[model samples]
Target: MTRRVLPYRTPSENVISAEDWHLVTPDGDIAAPEALPDWDYRMNLRLRRVVNVDLDRARTESGLPADAPLLLSAVWTATGSNLSGPAQHLRLPRAGTVPMKIDFELSGTNLGGLLLLDTALVLAERRPDARPASPRRAGSILWSDRRALRLQGDAPQFPMAVIDFSLTSFPDNAAWHLQISGSLESATMGALLLLVNERNTVTATAFANAAKPRQIDRLVLSAVYADAARLMVEHALSHEDFSEESDYPDDSLGATMLILFDRLFPDQSITDMRLRQRQSPSLFASDLQAAVTIFEVS
Candidate 1:
């Protein structure tokens, strides 16, 4: 593996040691695996890890002052949603070995695809009088590491919520609704939501067991996915601005829809599909049903 060359001195690789991340579950905490096949928007992730830093050796190797302020921090990034933010931060001891514990609670709505965890040790404050080859700038990295966890491997990979339909304008008996709002330029996470009616126990239960779905639950989920895809495609088709030539920001709603459209209608152009939908609405619906392969057994 190639290593990044820093202009300033850095500590040895052994200065910081981190344990594998643990996934906190209701039963107990377990070592996080490479992937979570059943992870969904309704599930929030709780993770924890322990790290030990040899501060004395780190400072000496990096030519930092004896009283230098160092910081240990963790940050998280979700590739699907294109969202990222700080997770945890702690001040390192001025001298001696320091042990730090990191706990991260990530919301499901803000996460999708790959979940990346970044941990780093940095100079917390600027030091102008430090040695010439020493780290002198604030936030100068001394050591860092990254870990990744795959969340899901399918479509409709958006945020979701379960609530009582009776409390809203939607029909009380509606099993679920896919809500799409905002312009295509908006972030996909903020533009789409899958709302399952809590009173619709069948639909709600299907999602609750999505991670380990039974045969019946699988059928229910497949139906839900097909319907959700239909709604998403129709919504995209309704917007004239959505086209193959249009440039959209990465992770934007328009970008997401463009990808979905390509997957659903591989060889068909947007103009042809739009014309077909307008000429024969019924036939278009059939075509979409076939495209989604609704309720097909896997």
Candidate 2:
């Protein structure tokens, strides 16, 4: 029998929250950043660790209520590079909007997908509010790594919500290109475990698929950042070595990056994300010290 998935995003819950938001125009036209109605996000990531996978007890995700809602969601999968095209094509989750106008589009960045998203210019800034986001309290199986989580706030004092999801290297859905998928499935935590173990192997037989092992762990994280500027600084510093082509092949830039990140994080677990400022005094001179948060989950 075919397995079923769940709706990753809920109405009342949020994937990531910013307590104080100043939606800005790209050209800096508007002083205050109003919530954007047209936008989309996608993640081409793979799970790193596994705690469990119970196929028989799978559950699906659903919509959220007025009090709480699912602001973001992603579907992950990896498959045979041989049987596929140059990059993985992902099917998007059934997108919903708020203020009834915020439209979105998500495409996995397997290789060329990143280039496509860069064209849209998705803007995300970190907000450090006092209160933690509550989804489980509202009833939802929100899972995320600290490295991939952030807070959304009402102003700047206290967070109105929390973030609890990240994209691991999952396979892209084939139907996304033509918009032909009948419906989006609600993936379970257990099904997620199975994905982590797949490793996106493209040439494996059915028996070989069963032999794969899963690597994933679930843990709640509490982290902090002074502001979005500080976080951006951290990110710039971390990416200083992003273009190093010495360790990878000349043709494989994106794949090389994925491998590089995995290597940097031997533990294979991302938690408690933060932006680090440059060392004080001489070393901190210029823009080197004021880099943004060092994070990349593509």
TM-scores for all candidates? 0.74, 0.15
Total clashes in model 1, counting residue pairs 3 or more apart in sequence or in different chains:
0
Q: How close is candidate 2 to the true structure, as a TM-score?
A: 0.15
Q: Residue-wise lDDT of candidate 1 within 66-171, one digit each (tens)?
A: 8999999899998777789999889987899878999879988889767899989999999989899999999999998899998854557798899999999999
Error of 1 at 179 (Å): 1.3
lDDT of each: 0.88, 0.23
lDDT against true structure, model 1:
0.88
Off by over 4 Å in 1: 1-14, 17-52, 61-71, 88-108, 122-142, 145-152
Which candidate has the highest lDDT of all? 1
| Tens digits of per-residue lDDT for model 2, 1-298 | 2222333432222322322212233354232223222221122222121112111111122222222322222222212010112121211123332221112222222211112110000112222321233223322343321121111111111111111113332234211010111111111111111111122222112213222312211000001111322332333235544332434322132332333334443343222121212334244322322222222111
- The Cα error of candidate 1 at residue 168, in Å, is 1.9
